[model samples]
Target: MTGYGLHTPIEYLKGVGPQKADVLKKELHIFTFNDLVTHYPFRYIDRTRYYKINQLQADLPAVQVLGRLISLGQIGQKRSKRLVAQFVDDTGIMELVWFQGIRWMEKSLKVGSVYLIFGKPTLYNGQFSMTHPEMELYNPAKKNIGNLSLQPVYSSTEKLKQFFLDTKGIQRLQETLIPWIAKEIEETLPTYILKSQHLIPKGLAILHIHFPSNMAELQAAERRLKFEELFFIQLKLLKNKLLQTNKFKGHLFDQVGTTFNTFYTKHLPFPLTQAQKRVLKEIRQDTHTGAQMNRLLQGDVGSGKTVVALMTMLLAIDNGCQACMMAPTEILAQQHYHSLLHLIGDLPVSIKLLSGSTPKKERKELHEALMNGSLDILVGTHALIEDTVQFLNLGLVVIDEQHRFGVEQRAKLWRKNSIPPHMLVMTATPIPRTLAMTLYGDLDISVIDELPAGRKPIKTLHLFESSRLRMFGFMREEIAKGRQVYVVYPLIKESEKLDLMHLEAGIENLTREFPLPQYRISIVHGKMAAKDKEFEMQRFVKGETQIMVATTVIEVGVNVPNATVMIIENAERFGLSQLHQLRGRVGRGGEQSYCILMSSHKLSNDGKLRLQTMVKTNDGFEIAETDLQLRGPGDIAGTQQSGILDLKLADLSTDQLLLQEARNLVLGIFKDDSTLDQPKNELLRKHLSRQNTGISWDKIS
Candidate 1:
């Protein structure tokens, strides 16, 4: 065997010099042979079929043609110069054009020589022509040109092309690199798994992934590789969970005291939904297990997650311990404080709001209460993690909209007590189960899928700019019925490039239409000061304002049960998740609520699909799944910085079944051998150790 292996630097490869390797490293992050081998093609082109010149159609994908170059010349001035060639097949003639490589094409072409041309055909005026067609001299002796195998198309950049490294160039490098390491590659999975899953060997899968001989072989290669990728990730997450349960000790809350029973029996405002009851039971089971609870609470906007959280905190207080809830924004913190306060209803549990806007004197008193175990529950923004805000026996932490905070910030909250507190992070934005399994795989998840009783799903409608007057009339009608309305614009201020309506112009238009004394409108946005924004939100909440004009700043944490109308201006600029969240702002009250999505006539296909999806269903999970398909997992709520999303092949959108299978297989393996110390599990143990270099955040939730 040769000395070089997968670890060899890419520059030492046969066809790659230092300069070309540097470009590859910067453009495609290919620093080693393994990096290049694993940089699989996004797609492949069929090269076995050759289209006749006359059979070519307009706007068709790239096609291959065999023809003879009969004439070639340059036209136009230097700036507009283009090399044009007339190539004739047995049936007809077509023009091959190139605008960039004029001199090179002029020097390379020979008249009356048969050549192969491949490119997309475009119709200009009345004639079909190909621009920058790939040209090669036809040779009947070699079978490589028209082989049955598919041609790989690797992703490339203009900078890489400057060094003669485009898609075709990268394919050539793979051809040389794959064979060199194929023999040296080692199997990562055990023999039993490979046999049970009907997977090919690792070496053979890598070979076929780069250059498959047939469609079936390519699919098999993809299946094997995707399973491997997802399997290792599941193993890591499951192992983290196992280690957390075994290594970390948590403060046990083994009793339900007067506070929890009092609120449930008398002060509870409404009956709890079955889904909420199930989630509370899950939390209750975790808190008393003597293991630190790292749980994710997911529910739709009006699903009463806050009530479940309040009850969980009461359990902590009943055990002679303190509980704290942290929100990403000050507005959300205050909302939680008021919600909990109203729910407590003289239950003798102390709850206070501490945020950046809190006065110094109030913070001092709140700190004292917390240190002396007097503050039963504290709700605040990131301020709760401050050094001075210490709890006497911090037992539980509830983070609302947890994705908005960074990892280190969440870690700070976990480090508040000598023993890590029970963590129950909540999100109103629904996450698909596949995504939840991958992103929060380490955390135990409990979803409150059902909305509260007596709540109606928001009636969603899509409207163009022409329907503005009618929408205004409808808004006035709702306001006349003693219901508040919300007009959410995508832009807070006028933008030069965007022609959408801004909040300032929208407020002006509303004032002109509704007039002064009859309609009281409040304006709020991210740019407004904390107190001012809170005052405007409070006005809308209290029915003092008939209409509230704002940006997406009100998308979360602003709960106005009386606001029955939500009109989102330029709704096409927002994504499906954002649109769903904005729609959730309404539908909190018993009366039938409406969410009107207003946009210009000009809309992309994606924009249309998003609006249509919102109008079709109120199921946030379905909407979230569609959103995951429309926009991949990266742009979702919390998966952006999740290093696990750097998946090379496994698509979280389409690979749901595969992900589940992998997860189940990992579970089976762990059930048999938790430590992976058995002889049959040594491969997995070695692979996991090799990948365990990053800092473990399992204990911090």
Candidate 2:
């Protein structure tokens, strides 16, 4: 069908009136004929094979049988009422039962009718029976099952079933629509691509996806559709990348002058790792090219990302342009400000902190200094993105924990100057290759995949609740060694009231065990005021407290070198990526650090796998890959509502090869035709124009 025909209202389709259309709209979001056509089935059943009643087994999977409804009757009273039909084939007899829809089934079913029933078989009292089996009238003389090979099973909800829009009802709609759609639908991909990829026609793929002739056809249809979905995504990303590099002219920072060299040689605390050096070189090249620099820096926690960021900012300063770094939280912003302040000891550069908690008079002076070109580097939270917080010749922008900030928020920072700044978005979360390709394909990517020298991998240990005393003893031992500890909880309050151990109760328990004068503990969580959280964090940082009991609020920002033991309460409740981040809070210093995962005995399979992954390896990328597999991309990236991840058919976990191939294909196409204006690529251009408007944040990052 043409685009106009595909966009036709679902209410106008055959056998669908306004009420049924509204039900489909509300329940499944199927508004247009295209939506209905693209609602692919999750699985399929083989209708070519039928089992006789005598061959039925309770443990067998769903089976199909041809039989006659010899008798029908109602059994049991009121709520327990059920409609039962005695079905018999040439070999033997079996019972078909319906409980909840008894009245409807009783009114519709006819006795002595030949029916094709499909359902899972169960044995009750030595008799074979099927519950809520799918039934249809059989006519062998007319060859009713002539083309029935693989029967597609669609997903439907209870609400949809009430409106007669069950799986079978949807299948009937497809049966009525696919023949016309297959004949009228236009091809979306270019002829060259279709030929090179050996892909079936778009319309044929659509038909086969919903109603396939065989297993091979279904697989081919899936492959084609997956490729198309991933192809368009990569095309948009790479195109945006091309547009940014070609269109936005960024500030030129081609000098390695006083600030960067003086800090690198004079007051540098340690040598930069090769990975860090490599990333800086990449950024260095990007800034020198004069194209707007939008690079994503990925590294594990404690991998010297801040140092790289500072050096990049120094490069900007050396080029006579100001730089700024934005963090997601006040604690992180403060940490960066202090860490930078300490690192650039007696250096000539002027750095300041800006956040919501900054006093009015201080904010006024900071703003003045910022606009007068006196402030070389400004680190702050979301406060830096406000309209009043403008910068003088802002040339470089570094965002920490980039995913926590929305794209629009980052875009606001991008608009700080007339010409967009060199954007360096830093994330400690290691992204899987597939996810990074799909979610961040538009941005240039650089990964610092190694840790700095003298850093030892944190040893991970899993413990059950029964080992509480031993864990407490170990904590005391660590505390006695003059090394601090951290106890993290998933919840702050007792509101959960379930098996989870919240922070408040944990505090009471800790106080009882460690007793005041000898052991001081600080408590923090998301609900605390900014100042209060900062005070508690400082206590931990200054080693005034032996243990800090907090929630995941400390996951990203708090850095303490003296703290060596991290006890995560109810660690099973955390995702793998989160657990890794929490584990990263310790082990910052040279001494060997340990991460103890304390959980109840009721860990689920996923929870167990997460713990096992933590214990097995300290590689953030590996944990991220496992996290993607366990939680899927939306949960890991928290971009489900961004419209960037609104994929229908492609699975990021399993389709990595296809995604890479699609990206490579796009790169190849761009080499030949940067813009799809050539006559041979006309189909691709048209299809892209018809796609949903590109993501607004693509150009900025």
Candidate 3:
């Protein structure tokens, strides 16, 4: 216990002194004993299974074989040099090779000794080979429990290997430390929890997780550790939610006054879909709960989320409280401003716009109007968060494309009001339900699942770049019908590294194909000046341009009802979510919209999956789920920075059952004991207080 506990420095462990300790800290972040114990293997191997040389297959994951080394020699020149050896068993012979650590391995190889080797097998030139295999002397007396147990394989870097701290080296240190770690560690879960969940004790789980004697033991170890890790996360999120709901008093907008009802009855352009009405009902309920509301709204592109946000804002206005909607980009903010203005025609609501490009005098007038409580609804980007832009009675805040903003920026919005205005965060990028539950676990989620009634399902097609002329013909036909077209390139300039279509090349190609008098073209990109970009986007939106050549700048909010064709150049470079959002740019009008995904023939498997997903279905949730499985939660747009998805073991995409179980258990516990102050829940509080596995999402959300 003195040498090994949660806080024991990793440097004190055997075989880990100053040099190796520094590498461990820098490379793997193993600063303490708990860090080492919890550095669970991404995978493990069963050492007991041994195959003959003849049994080796190219597709084999990792196979173990016993043979006697017949020869050892070096091959190739300086940089390409490798240590090559051959081993022969009673059945056959196979080659073993090592490109790294060649000098050390060449000296260590014994010519005639029986050796046990394990590695992934590859077949080349009709011969079997194993590169960089783990080898050891095979002796019955020395190969006892260690040989029978599942061996851990840790991830290592070239730098770590240079310091003699590769997977095998780290495993040796673990072998030295595991005995004491098993004895000194204390259970993190309570006795009641362990009993109810049928979990093994903490110390034993740690031991078995690194070196399990059998498959059942390994499974049990994984189950216990995953439960503990996921449990703490769920508890932390629930606690944040509870604190927000309990500690902060909400601005009660109980009145369903004129602005809300009058607009719903008359000025509404179309009857609200059942999903929209349902979301509005939920938001309406949250505003009057006497507790600050933190809600997340998720819907596909053109799913009428903005309409719901507009109605909710009117609720705040009806109660004599002002509301503001913040977007990630100025272009998006302006789009919202125009959309809301059109929706609220003749309604007498004084809606104002603010962004980075706002005129000085106009900005001053907006500030005055907002301070005087005369602005009913304000729409803008981060410019709205300026300290000088004070709100008179900001009661509700609607943030569009919520993922584009960081957690701190959102928290800054929270600080804008004394009691923290009711928040409605929205994203058109559909997140999987399981992910939404974890990533936005603290916020109540309202999903508008169905699209509007008049809208038709978009027709999607995958095309090779060789078919560009055919696509051009289709675009010409669409333009002939007075419909605009969008030709989106994945890049703004011709990047030498990536041979994809850029905006400049695309504009030239389109001009040559469409000719001067036949089509007017507008180009926009991120590198363009804000004013110029906005001008080009507005020209395209107003149908002054027959074709718009742009980057993903149109991915967020550039609504053109007359645009009937969306041709994405190098579509394979775009992710599933981005492709879906870009496809959303079209299909806004009723004239049979089409989204043509144009990419080169050389698409990787992942790129093929993305393109196939776009062509297969328009279901955003389904596309989001496939994207999660393909790109993982870390690479997804929002979850990368949000530490909520920084899970070590439990995968939000696949481990839904475990997440649900943990969430349900926390719900039950909080129902009876909100603070976890009950006598039986003391262990939970202690565990949560010391939770430092990764970044804490409590303060972020």
- Most accurate candidate by TM-score: 1
Clashing pairs in 3: none
Could you tell me which 10 consecutive residues in candidate 1 have the lowest summed lDDT? Answer: 692-701
TM-score of each: 0.96, 0.95, 0.94
- TM-score winner between 2 and 3, please give it: 2
Model 3 worst lDDT run, 10 consecutive residues: 692-701
- Which residue pairs of candidate 2 clash? 1-184, 1-185
Candidate 1 per-residue lDDT, tens place, 1-701, comes to 27898989999998998999999999889999999999999998987789998888996899999999999999999789899999899988888899987898899889999998889998878777899988879887765422334888899999999887888888888888787688788999999999999999999999888888789989999999999999988899988888888888998999999889999999888899999999999998999899999999999999999999999999998998899999999988888899888888778888899999899999999999988888889999999888888999999999998878887788888889998899999998899888888888888999999988999888999999999899998998998899999999998889999898999999889999988898899999999888899889988888888999999998888888888999999999999999999999999989999999999999999999999999999999999999999999998976776566778999999999999999999999999999999999999999989978243763245
lDDT of 1: 0.89
- Winner on TM-score between 1 and 2 is 1
- Model 3, 349-416: lDDT tens per residue? 99999988789999999999999988889899998778888998899889888777877777777778
Model 3 earns a TM-score of 0.94
What overall lDDT goes with each candidate model? 0.89, 0.90, 0.86
lDDT value for model 3: 0.86
The residue pairs found clashing in candidate 1 are none
TM-score of 1: 0.96
Per-residue lDDT of candidate 2, residues 1-701 (tens digit): 34447778999888999999999999899998888999989888898899998898888999999989999999999888888999999999888999877878888889989899989999999999999998878866554322467988888999999887898899888887777777767888898999998999999999889878889999999999999999998888888888788888999998999889999999778999999999999999999999989999999999999999999999999999999999988888988999999999999999999988899999999999999999899999999999999888999999988888887898899989998899998999999999989888888899998888999999999999999999999999999999999999988878745768999899999999999799999999899888898889888898999999999999988889889999999999998988999999999999999999999999899999999999999999999999989888898765664567777889999999999989999999989998898998998888777774364574465
